[model samples]
Target: MKKESKTDWPRINAMRDEDIDLSESPELNETFFKDAVVWPAQKKQITLRLDPDVLDFFKSQGKGYQTAINKVLRRYVEAQKHH
Candidate 1:
């Protein structure tokens, strides 16, 4: 038997709120968001040098390449903190 994927967005959106099922969903409360950290939207400007290949790779991904690079660097910093 083939397994069904859960990408049925149209059908899901058409559902009435009362007809929707939420038995498997976890309850969210104030405690769930108490410790959440909010990041500042402001960005700092700095000059940095990168190898030609590295810069080219991100540039090929089209717009928002700089943001993508920042995200990768952020993940690296977060991982290093756990050590």
Candidate 2:
């Protein structure tokens, strides 16, 4: 995990328009995104191998570690689709 910088927002906002890329960005259509209901997909059980530290980190957060892992994986899948 990486430490987040508190001042990153100002730096990002200061970036030049030409420095930004929107080629892969989705269109901001209100009608397309409005009233969206994201229901979780059915889950399947399986054994997965993970680094000891990675497993320990989520487990240390106490309860719902499995759900946290699922959320992380889902985000990764969604991100990959945009690329």
Candidate 2 similarity to native, TM-score: 0.54
lDDT per prediction?
0.87, 0.87
Which residue pairs show backbone clashes in model 2? none
Per-residue lDDT of candidate 1, residues 14-67 (tens digit): 999988888977567787577455686889999989999999999999999999
Q: Tens-digit lDDT track for model 2 on 20-74?
A: 9999987878865874537778788999999999999999999999999988998
What lDDT score goes with residue 47 in model 1?
98
| TM-score versus the correct structure, for each prediction | 0.55, 0.54
TM-score of 1: 0.55
